[model samples]
Target: MNIYIITGTSSGIGGAIARHLVDAREGVITISRRENIPLSRIAKTNSSFFRHYAFDLTQTGKIPELMEYIFTSFKEVKLNGIALVNNAGTIDPIGPSGKLDVSGIEAHLKTNLVAPAILINEFIRLSRPLKVSKSILNISSGAAHKPYAGWSNYCASKAGLDMLTQSIAMEQSAEEYPVRIISLAPGIVETSMQQKIRATSAEQFPMQKKFADLYKNQGLSQPDTVASGIIPIIFSDKPESGTFSDLRYL
Candidate 1:
């Protein structure tokens, strides 16, 4: 059986992806700061196939131990494939770089870059001997390529994440069993993150009105729709490692 581990599964695209996997009878393990009630209830009936862990990804020091525990728990299961979806991210400190708080900037980097880096490192080390397909999908954004007035922190972190994915893919290509990795931009979706963006002051985010208008005009993609597009890429071998993709183009 194939197993997938997804972060930020408490809501939005991560939650939708987890739900879809569970529906397809795939083994799914989710991590989030809080429990996803719907997924928890469903796991009650499919205990062996679904698992959840309430985890704060910002605590980077504890990730190695957490990964060890997760891998050990599934040691007995014969697996065909295993994947990691780095979907947990933060878009705080949304303002001009000069006005952004240092603490908030640190927190943003920790969640969007540091935590995923550590998770990918540990995942590779632990899964090295598994003799199964291994993949990593990083949920990136257009902000990584385009700069926004108030999204300095978000853009920098995502850019770092995309480069990290590319570097790791290159290193793994020479290995006997390489892990496939991709950084995908999911496009604008109707998520809590978007809500936060829409609520930002126009003085801070000059483009706030653009996002607000997108919502007003019902132009935002639904989480379920984005998840449906991403799920196939996660399980398929269509995209080459180290490449970048956008859901709108696919």
Candidate 2:
């Protein structure tokens, strides 16, 4: 049985992916701060293997215990493969560097960078002895490579995530069952995050008009579309580990 563990499945890309997996009858475990009502409804109708954890990633201290509980709960089932999608992220503190809130900046880094790093560490440690195929897909962004006027925290966190993916891949290469890892930029998806970006004032985010125009022209990709494109990549072995690519180009 192929199993997938995904973060931030309350909505958007994560929600889309979880729904797809449920429809396909694949084993799925989702983590988010709130329950996904639509996903819960679909899972009930499909009778698929599905579980949801209402946990906040910012509580970084409890991640290992959470991961342990998840893995232990699945000990009775035979698993052919397991994958983790580090898709939870935040783009807050969207203003000039000097004007950003100290607490918001801390929360942003915890969600975007530190949480994923700790989760990956636990996943690798717990699944290392198992011979099953293991993989990690980090939902990165184009902002990681470019510096926007007001996304300093977001940019820094994503860039650090990419490097973390690369460094882990290098370290795991020699393991008997090394995890395949990739950091992918999913392009501009039409999610609530985009709405937040569009709503930001020009004084805070100079690129607000650019995103607004994207929405006005219907230039943004839908959540399901991006999910469809990356689902195959997530399950396939075609891409080398530590690779970073944008969905638009892929």
lDDT of 1 by residue, 23-107 (tens): 7778889999998998878766766478788889989999999999888777878899999999999889899988988889888
- lDDT by residue (91-148, candidate 2, tens digit) is 9989999998899999999999999999999999999988998999999999999999
Model 2 residue 235 CA deviation (Å) reads: 2.5
Instruction: Tell me the number of clashing residue pairs for each predicted model.
Output: 0, 0
Model 2 residue 222 lDDT score = 98
TM-score of each: 0.98, 0.98
RMSD of each: 0.9, 0.8
Best-fitting candidate, measured by TM-score? 2
CA displacement after TM-score superposition, residue 133 of candidate 2 (Å): 0.9
- Pull out the clashing pairs in model 1: none
